[model samples]
Target: MKKIKGIIDRFEEGFAVIEIQGGTKDCPKDIFPKDTQVGDVVYITGNQVEIDKSETKKLAKEIEDLMNEVWED
Candidate 1:
């Protein structure tokens, strides 16, 4: 297994496109939370492009809540 890190380019339906260190790979949506968006740095562990549901969901929720904070509309 290898560690892949990159920024999320796009997320739609149940999939996400990540610009990995070597290349871009399609990640499943379930791995990440419902609120994941573009430009978020993500770390994944796998031989091939795959989604880690637990890890992604946990991080996604945390990021989602943090992004929801607003000082002024």
Candidate 2:
């Protein structure tokens, strides 16, 4: 078993679009936790996906800071 990091890009139909190292991949939505959402950082181990809450929050803050910088006058 191996652990891979990814971000939840979006949900479509019955799948979740995940951004991985090389590109994006789709996995069945049911395989993820029910509370999962877009922008969540996840760790994939075999067929299981687990949310990395701290990483997700850190990423959100980084993006927010970038956005704020861009909008500052």
TM-scores for the candidates: 0.53, 0.95
* Residue 25 accuracy (lDDT) in model 1: 82
Number of clashes found in candidate 2: 0
- In candidate 2, what are the lDDT values of residues 24-65, reduced to their tens digit? 999999999999999999999988999999999999999999
Model 1 over residues 1-73: C-alpha lDDT tens digits? 6677766888767778888766888888677655556766677765333345566667678877787874335
The candidate scoring highest on TM-score is 2
Error in Å for residue 12 of model 1 = 3.1
Q: List the pairs of residues colliding in candidate 1.
A: none
Q: Give all candidates' CA lDDT scores.
A: 0.69, 0.96
Q: Candidate 2 overall Cα lDDT vs. reference?
A: 0.96
Candidate 1 wrongly placed segments (more than 4 Å): 47-73
